[model samples]
Target: MADEPDPQLSVPVGMFEDIEDLKATNAALIAEVKALAAQVTALADGGGADPGEALGGDEAAAGGEPADEGEAEAEQYPPFILLLDSPAYDDELRALIEWVEGVLVPGYLAEPSADARWCHLWFEHPVAVARLHAAWLAWQELTDPASCGYTGPSVWHRDHLDPALRELRASTGPFAGCTKGEHQVGHRLPGLVPSAWTHGDD
Candidate 1:
């Protein structure tokens, strides 16, 4: 009995199996890390293939082709504020405000004048909100190197920024009654003609 292995010191078969499993898992993880490192090195050396394609495989590298129509539409357009729910809208509005205050006002907005007016409470005006949100979306897309490349900023300035400013700050635009120092009190949207459908007219 003394020559035989002591039962007290014997390892469980299940324990050995668990250790083997862990070792295999660790090996797989190490291999994945090595692969990721190689990809990073390739990108650093300016390899021809896109990094997204390398990680996602050939399906993702299909020359920017989306897997489905819905995905394609989503990729093309940013989420519009009007389409969002209350919480999402609030979050988006906050981001838009940050961009407006931090980048737009300081960098592009000129001193408020009678000809080029601005309202302190511009958010209160629905038209102003819609216009600003559109411009902000364009700015985000055009400024990103991954989205539009080097010429994007120039195109954004010429097409999006200038037009939005001209419309919003025009004498007859949404900020018409506002001034440099004060918001327009008792501000009201322009009255619209009653809908023909509401009156049962063709």
Candidate 2:
């Protein structure tokens, strides 16, 4: 009976309950810390957009295929469209198409063809070039005609039209069969203006 008298003081039920609660809280905190670490990793890797980021795990955002950087770059600038540069199609045209598509298209599709071989190829498919030209004109119309300045076309015509570009146009490569008459009438592109196309955020 004397020893039993000190039971409440020796081990208080409230203290035991507090100890159990502390253990649970510590376990929960550990789990939360782990989850935060995973999210940090996810964010470091281009946050799931371009996998080329240093952290990796760069999943394409919005569930689409990862974009090619070169294609993206070419799209930013207007590249010279090589219509008749298929050498099996025509040697000069092939070289022109190769130069434009291989080198220029790799950058921006800006500037019209500058070389005679390129011009010849373009002339061979005048209709197509005309259509492209019309599109270019329309784009020019979108902006101030004065502001439609292109260094590539202007400079290439003025300076780089020598053997380098010429060789490219005439080099018996793949796209030599292009003709001047193909694009005589020109095809109407679907969305020439922003209002002509539908954009969906969904």
Candidate 3:
């Protein structure tokens, strides 16, 4: 109406709007890529991803289960101590002992009795060491707040702790014939019959 609005200028105005829209889209895409990169970096560094930001709000809200499960899955756990070699195994065992004496024994173990035996030299017995190490590893995983959450300890007790204690403290368990103060000095593993291939017609 106002002098026909200058037809040539109209095209430029429309093009300008399109360019602005494209710029906004590009900025949003860049932000998303940056966020993804940050998450990857965190995971590589053994630092777990942030739950709220990792999956985005809409996806997280859509399904509550994935986010909750992802928290534990994202955590990195150490390898079994028995799998390690020489000094590493020795080093880990020392730390394991610290946890056993400081946290495990004091908090969980019962008084030594004829039916429920214990040994001060439990480490001397390979089977006892293996069992305790397994329990200790489970303890580390379940007790972590970032991994197992609130129900971890209860689960550990039911699935790991009780079973190990039953075997370790039983009258005929690894500490058999051993007492709290007096470790059974001559404890020996039961002998196994030789294989036919090795002792053939001897």
Residue 72's C-alpha lDDT in candidate 1? 70
Scored against the true structure, residue 43 in model 3 reaches a CA lDDT of 81
lDDT of each: 0.77, 0.43, 0.76
The C-alpha stretches of model 3 lying farther than 4 A from their native spots are 1-76, 190-202
By summed lDDT, the worst window of 10 consecutive residues in model 1 runs over: 58-67
By lDDT rank, best first, the candidates go 1, 3, 2
> On lDDT, who's better, 1 or 2?
1
Provide the global lDDT of candidate 2 against the true structure.
Answer: 0.43
Specify the highest-TM-score model's number.
Answer: 1
Off by over 4 Å in 1: 1-77, 185-202
The C-alpha stretches of model 2 lying farther than 4 A from their native spots are 1-9, 48-202
> What digit string (tens of lDDT, one per residue) describes model 3 on residues 57-116?
434343334555666766655556656667877998898889889998899888888877
Residue 171, model 3, lDDT: 84
lDDT of 1 by residue, 7-112 (tens): 8579787997899988976776676566667788988998856766565543334233434644677776757775665787799888888888899899988899
Error of 3 at 97 (Å): 0.5
* Residue range 1-202, candidate 2, lDDT tens digits: 6656666677877998999988976776665555556667777864743324422222233223345654586576533433223443255444445545564445644333323223334434433343333344343334453644655455444343332334434523112343344322133232353432323355
